[model samples]
Target: MSWKKTSITIVMGNDKYPKGTRTATFNNIVPDPTEKQIKSFAEGLQLLSDGDTYLGSEVIKHDQLSAE
Candidate 1:
């Protein structure tokens, strides 16, 4: 398997969590994340998790050659 670089955004929500810290993974990737990506590409990543719910996901960074 090859390595793919992507800036995914994961927004979590629950009654116990507040709006300030609701966002699990903001915009940008782990290496160097900028602000937040309001328009996510994917969601529902934490269906198996507990109270943490996946609001959305966005792949800002990716390899164009991976398509081939």
Candidate 2:
């Protein structure tokens, strides 16, 4: 089996919505990426997406299996 369709969700929160959160989802990521890599990517994405209240991130991956 292998990992496929990997994605990362960047979560953010702001003073206006202290208990609320927002997220940005990026798909088609390289499988098994490092934390540092995700962080850097998220930071850059945040800048471009105008997300100033970065909280954290989550990585999601789908398992791919061969029938043969």
Candidate 3:
């Protein structure tokens, strides 16, 4: 399967809503995804752990994302 590249902004200041709401931007994709695909992809990624996901964050800005 061909996978597209995406960058998501995860605000994990705390595990509560309004504070932990995340934003994802899927760019350079061959074709735009459907609503189901979008939801599925985000949910799948959200299931990752700190050990499984190499996330980077700026302590000052509180912006979190997968480093690589």
Of the candidates numbered 1 and 3, which has the greater TM-score value?
A: 1
Candidate 1, poorest ten consecutive residues by summed lDDT: 36-45
Q: Report the alpha-carbon TM-score of model 2 versus the true structure.
A: 0.73
Task: Give Cα distance to truth, residue 49, candidate 1, Å.
Answer: 4.1
Return the top candidate by lDDT.
Answer: 2
List clashing residue pairs in candidate 3. none
Q: Residue-wise lDDT of candidate 3 within 1-68, one digit each (tens)?
A: 33335333433222444644443344443344455654555456657633223232211112236556
lDDT, candidate 2, at 24: 79
| Tens-place lDDT digits, model 1, residues 1-68 | 34356555566666676563365444435543444433322233444556565555444665455556
Model 1 ranges with Cα > 4 A deviation: 1-4, 26-49, 62-68
Model 3 alpha-carbon drift over 4 Å, by segment: 1-19, 49-68
Candidate 2 clash pair list: none
Alpha-carbon shift of residue 59 in model 3 (angstroms): 28
lDDT values for all models: 0.50, 0.80, 0.41
Q: Report the Cα lDDT for residue 12, model 3.
A: 29
Report the Cα lDDT for candidate 2.
0.80
